[model samples]
Target: MNLSPLQAISPVDGRYRNTTQDLAQYFSEYGLIKYRVFVEIEYFIALCDINLPGLTAFDKANYNKLREVYLNFGETDAQEIKDTEKVTNHDVKAVEYFIKKKFDDLGFPDFKEFIHFGLTSQDINNTAIPYTFKLALNEVYYPKISSLIEKLKELATAWKDVPLLAHTHGQPASPTKLGKEFLVFAERLEIQLNSLKTIPNNAKFGGATGNFNAHHIAYPATNWVDFSNNFVNNTLGLNRAQHTTQIEHYDQFAAQCDALKRINNIIIDLDRDIWTYISKNYFKQKIKEGEVGSSAMPHKVNPIDFENAEGNAGLANALFEFFAAKLPISRLQRDLTDSTVLRNVGVPMAHTVISISSTLKGLNKILLNEEVITADLENNWAVVAEAIQTILRREAYPNPYEALKDLTRTNQKITADTMAVFIDGLKISAALKEELKQITPYNYTGVF
Candidate 1:
């Protein structure tokens, strides 16, 4: 059968294709090929800039043309490399041959040999993958995350004064402002985002065994170690791992994955809270016409967007955990395990993007049920026990905790009138009584 969304195996590429389409520029097969070409071209330029003995003879004016190989790279260029890969049976080698073919086409036959120079597949893979991630983070991930945070901030400010009955252990406890609840998420996300920023986009760039053996042997007089460091760090905008085996250490990469997982976990927490609030009628969704919330029951507007966000966040976290745990480990020096695993780096991120989109949708559809929130707060006059007990203690009342506990724990429903009557019978002064009477759930939200 022809390729269809239903026919695809992974939902990232299938069911949520539109939500994750931007990931294709960073994590797809073509993206990998393009990055490999980018690394190769950049490395060649770095070599030229180093003023290597043989490279000094090349025409510096053609540098723009040289960069065009990658800058203007397209599907046809990718197909050409794939064709070459069929002959070479090695992906990185195909990139080398494709660059050489480009040089030959441009009549720079002497420069062809320097295309790949002394590099291994992991050298290209490590640099290319991290470079892709750095660009994607700057261009895609950060923007999306920033947008989500901004949306959260907008909601927080919009609902700042709105009082919400706080729930602790699934029971109404105290009162908190709705905006403050959203600010909690905004704060958590900002902290994680700062942590994410601290994680360096590192890459390995030494020779086959990360020893620079070929570079050393080829030009013993040249400081190839320093050269590799400068090329990886200065030219490519990645931190250079000085010591390694055949591949990158992946410790930093793992840290990044864990960071993303933590951020997603925070979003998951927010999703669950929002879902609970929706269930409690603290939030009512803006229902669309002809949309059925439940098939059997006509009166239903489910929190499916938050549910979808939660489910996708869980999937993203699972994959991110695997990446964090598995990528950093390999049989001494090198292994092929990381190669296949690295291909799916975008999968978790794609799911994260989907979750973010779903969450934004959920936030937009929510219509805060202010009447229900106010009614709940007004009815739960028992929440004021904490304040009353504190005031009682201030007046040197004996066993204030026991007094409030006895008054609140019974089967009687606590209301504003009942609390006022109880306060009127207290042994405290009339001034204290009046002060206590002024405390209502609506105005009892401790701080802004």
Candidate 2:
């Protein structure tokens, strides 16, 4: 079938295409070919700059022309490569042939042999994938998630003084500020983001194996190790693995997945909490005209955005866990497994982007029902037992814990009148009783 969003197989490309469209330039097959062409062209130009014997005659003026092959790479160019792949039966070799044809057209046919000289398919695949992956995270993922954190900060500051009854073990416990709860997520996201920054975008760039065997054999006197390091690290701006098999070790990539999984978990936690708050009537979502929350119930306005976020983030977390575990292992020298799995890197990322967008939407739609929150605090007056017990302990009252426990553990609800009557009957000074009476759920919120 001719592909449109509706006709696409995966929802990442179908139902949620708009949410993940930006990633097309980084993870799509066209994107992979474009990046391979870029690396090959840059490697050739770098060889020319180093005064490599065969490439010394390459014209410097045509460097921009070479760069344009990728900079202005179009669908036609990618299709041509794909057609070549059908004949060559090797994707990387097709990329090589396509670049060689571009060199011939650029009038540098003599220097075309230096295009993929002394490099393996892994060199191009590993370098190109990491290069684009880093760009995708920086350009797309970081900005979206950073905005979510900023939104949390905004909400936290706006509701900084709003009192919320804390729940422990599904029972009313101490009181907490609504804003402080929002701030907790922001703090967690920022810490994980910092850790994600520390991990290097690693790549493998040696020849066929971890060693520059071909390059060293061709130029025995030249330091090919330094050459590879400079090309992979300084030129391309990635970390070169000093040792590898036919492909990258992907250790740092696994670390990256683990870090992202933690981030997704935090987002899932926030989704569940916000969903609970909505269910408790502590948050009311702004209803849009003509929007249906439920088909049968007209008054229904579901917390669908948070629910969507929770589901997508959970799916992304599962994929991330698998990537972390699977990418680090290969049979002996190498296997085809990593290649197949690597193609789906965009799948989890697409889900993650969708979840982040959904969360931000859910947050924007929420309208806090402060009166409901306040009523909850007022109804849960027994939470003040802890404060009363602590104050009684300060006075060195005997059996203070047992005293408050006895008063609160009764079947009757602990309302303001109930506590007041109990305080009036206490065998303590009137001044101390008055001080204890001041403790209420609203004002008992601890310092953030």
Candidate 3:
């Protein structure tokens, strides 16, 4: 029972470990502990900068030495903290003791007491969690999403001129460019992404119970609010939540979750559409020499890639929804509910990464069946009836909609020849009849 990828309980660490291992640096236990140590060290440095009482005369030359506690943090350092956690039974306090131990080893025993002075565990946990989350998005999540969008744009641009029989209400309605359809999802994703960027990576920094209870009591004359703001914002590059309970209000965090869910939803939409396209033979998946689509069906080249993306997107969104709904609520000034839930923040993100990667793989494998796409357009010539009818309306033709409806709905197979015959039979002038006859599914894709 040694620890290995196969022994992991969650698929993020088990089956898809390689796909999501990049996130381990942000949301793993070691990542959180490392962040806690970082925040404590930086807080001590910030106190030195402010010339806070006894800490004012602290040596500036040891700043880099203090930073090295977390900068050179590694598996050994993490193991030491975990070992410390075993003794203290408090994760953040373990980080405090670990940093103090590092200070003691650095021969700065007098400076060790200020490592976590006047702060509750939440101050460390909340700040470290948000900071880690923000860095994960900037360093990992956003880049993945942007890469997907860029892939979509490439395909959309490549297929911009290809006409597709558009489906509305489960019926062929009009002709649209294949690229325009993809652009819809791309545009939607980009909009939500812009909004996601605006949301502050906020953290709860007050000592305990939302007020600087310990902070104010320790230094009554000092402006702890402004000090906390500067430390959280300028020092840590995160927004300080002005009001809170024992933890962050999580309103902005919930907003971030909702925004990620929105992006996942857009990918889900694209997955279903591409799956349908593959089903309809508009896309033929590239087959590996020995790949099996199904064990029983020898000829099946199924749309499994899009299906995988869709399934993972669904899972990601579900967890993201829970994060949005559950993180923003607590019993009172504090509760233990969000603690365990927050630990899984990387789970949804990992799934999202796997899903998007699947989607990209699916997109790359698609060999467009132009023959099938064009044949579909040809078979659905009845779609041109709208264009003809609209033109007839412009010409003041009597009952144009009724006329096209009667002509198209009778179901005598609205092929090219039949459409031509119907156009020739119209009471309009020959020139107008010829003009109406020119409308076809291929040429009817409107301008962008």
- Count clashes in each candidate, considering only residues at least 3 apart in sequence or on different chains: 0, 0, 0
Put down candidate 1 lDDT per residue, 44-85, tens digits, no spaces: 888898888789988888889899998999988998999989
Name the regions of candidate 3 deviating beyond 4 angstroms.
none
**What is each predicted model's overall lDDT from 0 to 1?**
0.91, 0.93, 0.90
TM-score of each: 0.98, 0.99, 0.98
Off by over 4 Å in 1: 1-6
Best by TM-score: 2
Instruction: Give each prediction's root-mean-square deviation over alpha carbons.
Output: 1.3, 0.9, 1.1
Candidate 2 per-residue lDDT over residues 1-448, each given as its tens digit: 5689999989999999999999999999999999999999889988888888877777898899999999999989999999999999999999999998988888888888888999999999999999999999999999999999999999999999999999999999999999999999999999999999899999998888778888989888888878888988999999999999989999999999999999999999999999999999999999998899998998899999999999999899899999999999999978889998999888899999999999999999999999899999989899999999899899998888998899899999999989999888889999999999999998998987
Model 3 over residues 371-422: C-alpha lDDT tens digits?
A: 9999999998899999998998999989999988998999588899988988
Residue 128, model 2: lDDT of 95
Backbone clash total, candidate 3 = 0
Pitting candidate 1 against candidate 2, the one with the higher lDDT is 2
Candidate rank order under TM-score: 2, 3, 1
Q: How would you order the candidates by lDDT, starting with the best?
A: 2, 1, 3
